[model samples]
Target chain A: MRVQFVLQEIWIGLRRNLTMSISLVITVAIAMALFGTGLLINKQVSNSTNYWYDKIEVSIFMCTKTSSNTSCNKADATQEQKNTIKSDLEKLPQVSAVEYESKDAAFARFKDQFSSTPGMVQSTKAGDIPDSFRVRLKNPEEYKSVSSAMLGRPGVDQVVNEQEILKKFFRILNGLQWAALLIAGIQVIAAVLIVGNTIRLSAFNRRRETGIMRLVGSSNMYIQLPFILEGAIAGLVGGILAAFLLVLSKIFLIDRLQGSLQFASQLSWSSVVGIIIFSVCVGVLLCALASFLTLRRYLKI
Target chain B: MIHFDNVTKVYPSQNRPALQHVNVAVEKGEFVFLVGPSGSGKSTFLRLVLKEERPSQGHVHVAGKDLSRLNNWKVPHLRRRIGCVFQDFRLLPNKNVFENVAFALEVIGKPRRFIGKVVPEVIDLVGLEGKAHRMPDELSGGEQQRVAIARAFVNRPMILLADEPTGNIDPATSIGIMKVLDRINRTGTTVVMATHDAAIVDAFRKRVVELEDGRVVRDQSRGVYGQAY
Candidate 1:
């Protein structure tokens, strides 16, 4: 019976302040959407990092006969020098696998990659391709160690790690993630304040009813339950809307963007689901907190 | 039952006490009238009994619980035994008459079945049976006061405190309200009314306690108003 009364009170209270309820819902929805976007971007960064880093390799470009640099004066490496370099690389504890790519083999691989791009294919000459050792390590962090060891070695002109080129990419992504997160934080604070003030106004309007409730021996929880539920219900509706927006963004925007940037096609569906769940939880919890704080003074039930 | 043992209440930012050192007692099922001019501590005395304001210098005992020792959590339990009606009517403007009365029983956790039966009975007792569906704003001042009365009595509390309940109504309506209160008092509910209405005081001639400058100037059975001065 008490539960029924409380539900009735909540229903009536919501109906009484319909405009405030809608405002609360919109505030929560926008905040959750911003926060959800930040989460999705953060997830995307992690996924891309893991995907690219796992395939990252240190490439040791062998000296060529026509190379002008003093480091390549000896010209092409002999079979004995190649065997010695390969054996030395295997001796390192961090060395997981070392594969040799001859100059002809490197040219063939390049041609296959740019086969569809005639402009890129015609731009590269056969002799321009460098014979290299594609070195894979047990951990991506060991790239620096392997690259340093391979540099200035006999018949080696330049040693490059693909991970270095992608470092700047990750840094930019990380900065964007932080920027989105900052915006989310600001929106969340504004949403909380809006929810608090709305509930406060509702409390003020019903001050007489609350006073009577207090006078009639109603417990504090009994009086606060309806208001808190009001905020939470608004928040829940907002969160679901935000989640729908996020899912739509993933399906439409992110999918289209990834289609153009094919390397990121592997972004996980699980991450999107995780973001939606997190956003909903934040929406409900923060609104409940704001409502509780607002009611602290008014009800005193 | 209520007892005030030399209770004194000093309001904040005031040079003098609102309720000077005074004492009084009223047994269960008794109807007492507290009469005084404005700022004579009549409201303060009622507030003291309600525990809304604490007596600064003495003890106030109601229903055997010392008001001074009652903590915040226990205040609600104490209030459950007492019903309060105000001059403002204090009905939720949006609620209909039935909801106003039902709210009293609702706050006390009365079952829906009990509330449905008791609310109508109380509304009938207050002669507001036809006005149950009307909002407070739509009702006349007399009807609104009757709704307030019904809300006060719906819980069947041991004590009912009315602070100028008829202050907003005309003489005829005031008499009607008094008759309803008299009917409730007949049912063994102790009644403490704080009012300055001389005519009502003289007509009922109950135990009247009059205050002057925070001091009790008169206490008499079958008394008339304005006798203290």
Candidate 2:
């Protein structure tokens, strides 16, 4: 109940175990930093998924003069075949939009994509790429409906779902996010153990004081208050350090991710700020809870 | 203000009961000495009154409340009314004598102004008047015990329990410690002390309750410490 006394006790305990407290602070900082990074990665993956899913297209290539498929019959797809294909795709409910790309337009796109490579642009011929229907589905995952229907169709050379390739990239990012989270989880456990050890040592050091306090009619809450505050203060310092680490990670890790993967949108500063707040709170609560549990087991008042 | 009705105490780890079928009572404002051999449950008697240890079989009552039924949360409140002194004089090594005594009142939420007024009075009562600022390590064994007594008595509790209050001090200093306890007892607080000092026990001529192997073997007024068996 005495603020001055409790504060004094906390200061004494922290000072006595200065090395241990410093280690505890560092452990908590690293754990919270990793946790924040994991959360940012989660946000990055989801943001990219949302951004790229909208642009995903399923391409249905039509037969060319040199098409090898038995259904192509060694002849280019006629205007009638193209019209029937376009009309059938439009009729399907899964299809949101269908745009026909002529062989000349496909060639132009290939040249534009490989503009930096002069040799690749010069070697590609217009007719080499067959005409195709770029089908945008209402749901990217619903590419299966269109692909299953168009496969082996007369005049169709191949049906390629763009989502499949994108899925592999997202899967790798998801794995990375999970790895960050897993390491963060382990670090959190380590932080908890350190917090527990720190509190136990503090309690042991102050056992005489606690004993005197107990005999003098101090409640269990009163006896445990200083120890609990010591843990919380250490957590608070660690959380602040972790906030700095999170800022560095946002600038170095997430920013670099956005730079290399330009197709995915960058994680906004507001979301990073939100994750920082959440991770700091988690750090404080985790240390406080660990200290409380450790006292319950070891310090009997 | 304390009563034990056929109390039996058996710790979980030990097969033998520390105190068996013990019945004793001390009236309010009484100074009683619990004299016995080392393992004869003298310490257990003081602990039971303080509610530090519960009786296994029979009921232990202090200030008219049965301790067996009292809630664990209420134990601190009970302890507030019972001052305890140990042989080792358990003082906060980091705090001075004044802060040590004030700690007792501070823990119980006493006001700063009130502690400022009362801590000096209690310190002076235990004859540590101007030595308030001295730390525990600086004080002698007798002065440290007096400081522990000051801390215990700062709240003006209804009962005082001293477990070997002079066990660590010399014969001359032990007399001074006993005098302080006697003065506190004169203030109408019930004092129950457990001791092994037969000379002081015989000199005091107070109510003596002797225990041998956890049973009350003698209970008499103005009694002396009997011969050791």
Candidate 3:
């Protein structure tokens, strides 16, 4: 009720529990940093996946002279078979566009793809290349249906999508993001519990003082206000420290990664800023709630 | 100002009731001594008036309001009208005597200017005028008790409850504490004090209420501390 006295008591309580307060700050800071990082990385991963999905093409390889699959054993795909396949693909509602790649075009693409390695180009010949149909689907997720439909068709060697190749890479990014988030979850819980324990200890230590106040007609909120403020201040400090760490990582780690990864899309500042604000709010609010509940349970007025 | 109608108290951990069939009343501006031995419900009597403990049966009333019917949130308001002191002289080790006394008015949302004016008056009333800046640890046991009394009386309550106010102090300092309590009583505030100090009880020669096994065995005006042990 007395604002000045309550503020003074908060300062005193924080000072007296200096060690515990410091530890609580550090714990909340570390947890918030990890939480922000996890959020940012998740955004990055999702952005990367969506970008790659648009570029994904369902490649339908045609039979060639060296092809060994039963579907391709008879001979190179005849002109009628190739025409039939093209018409079939166009008829499917899921197919957006289709491009035909002849053997000569495949050989040219192979050479250009291996231009950096002269030996790779030297080892390949025109007849060694396979003709294919590059099919773009209206929805990338429908690639599964296209792949299955073309699997055993006449003169078809294989049906493959680019997403399958990038699966290994996306798996790693998602795994890292999940691991970071899981650890952050655990750390946040620990931070809340640490705040709770610190409040309980301070309450126990100051029982004598509070008992006197209770007798002197102080309300429960009046007695608990100082401790709640202490927890909130510590949480705010932790949030600030975490925001600092997140900005540092963005400059030193993420920006540099984007420099070499020009093909990949980067997350916007709003997302990082959003995460910073969210973590800070969560830190302060959660700690205050924990401290308040702890006082209600243990620091009876 | 205070009344107990056949009040009985039973703690969950103890089989027997602390106070049984207790009926007592004290008028406004009266100084009453509650004399009893160990485990004879002195503390319980004070606690009931403060609403710290609810009676298991019967009713306790203070300021014409039945405590059993009082809302939990209204307890603080009720206590604001009553002052309480204890034997341990529970003082905040971090605060000085002045701050401790001012704490009472501060919690009840008094303005700063008013607290500034009233803190010194109560400190002087408790006879600790110059020692206002002394921390609890800096004061003697008696002076600490004086600070507790100053804190309790700073709000100028209608009633004052002292549970063993002199239990932890020596006979000489205990007299000083008694004199301060008596002085506060003379200022038109009803005073209810529980004590085992037979000397102070007999010397003060006020209304004496003796309890034995949770029942009032003797109550008389201008009475001495009768040898009932």
Candidate 4:
């Protein structure tokens, strides 16, 4: 019976403070949306680092007539020179596998990789792309060992480790994730302040009722329940709205990016599901904490 | 039912104590009038019995429980045995008369079945039988006080504390409110009222405990409201 009464009281309170409740719902939704975006960015950064680092290779470019390196001043690498270089790379314990790419094959792979960037793909000629030996490492962290060994070798123009390029990309991703997190933090604090103010206002407006209730022997918990429930309802509504916006953004934007940029790793289904659940829980938990703390401070009864 | 042993209450922000070494006791089922001029510690006396304010140097015992020794969590149980009414009536503006009365029992976790039976019975006893559906704003001051009285009595408290229950109403309404208190007292509920209404105090002819500057100046059985010094 008391539960029923409390529910009725909560409903009445929400209705009476409809505008405040609506603003609270919107604030929580926006805050949680930013939080969800931060989570996604963090996951993307980790996923890309793991996905790319495992497949990253060190490329030893063979000398050609267009090459400027003094080390590659000689004629194009012969079959014997190529085979000997490949054998030497394989002899190194850190070298997992070595594959030779001719100029034709390099051009073909470049075209395939940049197919979506039609302007850049069309600008490249058959001979413009370099012929090189792609060396996979047992541990990507050992890229330094392979690059130093291949550098200055006869008939080699350049030794480029894919991990170096990936490192730069990951640095930018990490910075972006941190920036997103900072934004989310500010927004969550804003949402909490609004919620606290709304609770305080509601408590002030109902002081007469609470004063009477206290005089008639009502417990503190009984007086606080309705206000707490008011906050929770706003949070629950905001959580639902945030989840919807998150999923909509994923479907309309992220999914399209995933389709066109197939080489980049996408977020896993289970992790996305976890994010949705986390968004809802965080919203409710934050509002509950805010409400409880504010009420304890301001509600005399 | 109520005892104050050398109770002295010095409000922290005030230079003078609200109650100073005051001593008073009321037996069960007695009607007592706590009469005093403004700021003579009548409100403080009632507040002490309610445990709303603790005595700075002494102890208060109400309904067989020592309030000074009572845990804050256990204060509610002590309060449940005491009913309080005020000059303002303190009725919830949104709720009607019946709901205002039923709210007292509802808060204490009383069974709905019990509330359903006791609320109407008490409302009838307060003689607002047909005004149960009227909101507090829709009723006269006397009727509103009756609703407050009904709420206090619906819990069947052992002691009823009224801090100037008739202060806001006219004399005609004041008499009606007093008669309701009289009726409730006749049913064996101890009554303690704080007021400045000399005529009502003199007319009731009950035990009057008058305070002067936070000290009890008079304690007379069937006393009259005294003249100003």
Candidate 5:
């Protein structure tokens, strides 16, 4: 009837079943933590994909004096030929930016990019580098058009899109994401059943009280609300614990694990906050559902 | 007030009916006793009046509501008018005597102000004024039953159905419980108590209804327990 009356009953019932309540809270927290981790990783993968995808460019390497391509001749490209190629690429509607790199400039860029991998840089000679045009497209999907146009040119050796490599990386991350989601789903279901059964036992133990309440003209809502609130209280506690665990994981696990992987440093603060809120909401909703279903059969009030 | 018209209850797996074509009536403010040996349908009769079990055939009307026609949602409202005291003294063990008494009012949404006044008054009526704060486990069998009686009467129900209210207590304690019931009945509340205690039955000598093998064999005014046979 009154909110205070219902709350009082909930408090008393929860106190009587302290062990069951604690178990429910722990189970919910663990399950929500696993679920939260999976979601966070999925979010990180998407964020990183967007970050890298936007920066990806198509590289067209031109044949030179020592190149193996048959289209290349002994003489290198003249300044007019280089200007013509850059002008043609820039004229295309899809081409946003086209920058040419000379053999020496390309080599220097390669050394800068692979500065940490000195062994890789030393194994290759400077003349082995080819002059190339780095073509940035307005849309990454136009990479195919740019590649087709530049592939058969007189001085072209090959046209390579770095987005293909990123695609392969994303495929593997996606697989791991699904695997984590499946495991998280199973744990959530198991947690729900555990909470449901615990509430069932509490309902069974207090069946006489429920029966008396029914006899004394208590409404179905009045009779059931206390048990529902009990489950929700357990869920609330679990949610708090889950938020704590997620925050701890972000601070300790993600932050520390980033030291081993350079890109993981990009995991954002918003992602951590999102995981905490999402985990707590899931915990509360699942526990409420479990309590509702479990009480339906037992409480007949 | 209560009325039964040819009510029959056949429990699952039992060849004979628990109650067979039984008919009885009790008007407002009347005190009646249902006396029978164990397994004679005394409990079943009480349960039927409360709609705990619907009659297999015929109608059970209590407090002007036809229980056979009543919806599930309406059953609680029906029960609100009829208070029940069980033989086991079904008190919530965790609750103190005062809480146990207050629970009845709480369930019906009585405001705390009303509960504060009515609970102590009912506790005093049951001679439990000093033990209001004692838990059920802390009380003796007689005191526990008294607490149960207090809970039953606190709501001022229109009809009280007490099933063996004094069965577990000694004769002296049984007398104390009988006096409490009498006091409640004096306030114009109908009391239907089912008991097998013949000594108390003879001493009270109120209207008695006797049941045997799912049938009413005797109904008399100021009757002894076994005078019919």
Candidate 6:
């Protein structure tokens, strides 16, 4: 094949349909960016789940003098009740380890956790946080057993499983991921249709050339090479744009979310780069394939 | 170099067969004029030689290969050995005359220097020497047809098929076009041209095969175009 001839043909085809080509590039870029974002959200969700699942602990808060529960009756649990509760939690197979936090220690831990916000630290008194037992489960999924056993005990005000809260947060992240992927799916369909339309129009415009080529014994592949390369070039440009969009999304969207949420693990730069490469490849392949199929129908040779 | 054995062509949408039970042979270096009315399958006969349309029931052999058995991938190879010209002078409107002629070689992957040498030579042969830089729109109908013929003949194929090469040109201009085809025929390329011009046929006195309503009514050697049978 004459490389220069094919390249010249591609240049002519693209220039002839400049507006359509621009729109095709933009559509492909949006589709690929959303696709990359979906993948990034997928990565973020998995990273957070891995980072947080292992550290999940079920907290069993004991009654204090301020507690008005039926079991506590606005009185602090006695020493015997505390011992009994801690011993019971330790006896459960699901409970791996138990650490008791006194009221003063709980208040100190709260201050330490909220140290970034001085207003929250200043408003919380020592007695505001009740004493609690932090239970680590061998299997986080078995938190139900430990929580059920500890709830409504004479010394216990309430039991909370950290994994449940994490599940809710992760659920929201999963919804966002699905939403991104869904929009990406629609955009991909749009991009593919545009690629097909562009190819058909180009083929129609150059029907005279192609007819002459067919008469001169030019092979089908020789005739199709320029059109296919046209799509691939458009795809390459769009993919480059999408790479920029993906990087920006990581910096302004994901990293910012991590900054505010403070629990999601950091997404590595290398992984973002990897996702960018994958999205670009997908864009190129999709465009090439779409044009190829379109040509098969519109171009007889 | 071209043979049709009991050939028949039937299009799916029409009840009438385009060409029916036709048998004819044109040897190498023969200039044969296929004289027929509009629906008499003159174009179909030329199309069969180019493998553009297949005979629904018979066989077509070009360069001694059975066209029915020719694989789809091998069709281009078969077409490369045969040149075809259409009534429309299917030249790329955007390309100049030289570029249009060179496009044939370029599409088939000919080298630049080789195209540079042969394109102008063929343009000179077709009597379009200094008009190489003009586009199709700038050239007259006869000049455009000459460019189309040049493109078809550039690769030096063994056979040339012309379907109404003079269909749209004036009589004076068509005479020039026929002279070009005649010159190409002298170089040992078998030329089968379909035309309704009885005057050119009688003037050339080449072998004439006349068709009427899909069947060969007469085949005469060095014959003039006869009246409708």
Best by DockQ: 6
- Give one digit per residue, the lDDT tens place, for model 3 in A146-195: 88888888888888888787787778767878888899999999999999
DockQ of each: 0.70, 0.64, 0.57, 0.70, 0.64, 0.73
lDDT ranking from best to worst? 6, 2, 3, 4, 1, 5
Candidate 1 C-alpha error for residue B153, in Å: 0.3
Query: Of 1 and 6, which scores higher on lDDT?
Result: 6
Q: Better model by lDDT, 3 or 5?
A: 3
Q: Fill in the DockQ of model 1.
A: 0.70
Q: What is the TM-score of chain A alone in each candidate?
A: 0.76, 0.80, 0.74, 0.91, 0.76, 0.91
Q: What does the lDDT read for residue A28 in candidate 2?
A: 95
- Every candidate's fraction of true contacts kept comes to 0.63, 0.71, 0.63, 0.57, 0.61, 0.80
Considering TM-score, which of the candidate structures 2 and 3 is the better prediction for this target? Answer: 2
- Report residue B100 deviation for candidate 2 (angstroms): 1.1
- Structural similarity of chain A in candidate 1, as TM-score: 0.76
Estimate, for each residue in A5-76, the C-alpha lDDT of model 6 and write its tens digit. Answer: 999999999999999999999999999999999999999999899989888899989888787788888888
Q: Judge candidate 1 at residue A288 and give its lDDT.
A: 88
* Backbone clashes in model 2: 0
Off by over 4 Å in 1: A40-55, A63-94, A102-129, A138-145, A249-268
- Of 1 and 5, the candidate ahead on lDDT is 1
| Cα deviation of A300, candidate 3, in Å | 1.3
Residue A246 of model 4, lDDT score: 76
Q: Once superposed on the true structure, which residue ranges of model 2 sit more than 4 Å away at CA?
A: A61-94, A100-133, A138-142, A148-158, B227-229
Find the candidate with the highest lDDT and give its number.
6
Interface RMSD of each: 1.2, 1.4, 1.8, 1.1, 1.6, 1.3
* Per-residue lDDT over A81-151 for candidate 1, one digit per residue giving the tens place of the 0 to 100 score: 77878899989899899999988899999898778788998988886788888889899888888888888
What's candidate 5's DockQ score? Answer: 0.64
| Model 4: lDDT of residue B54 | 86
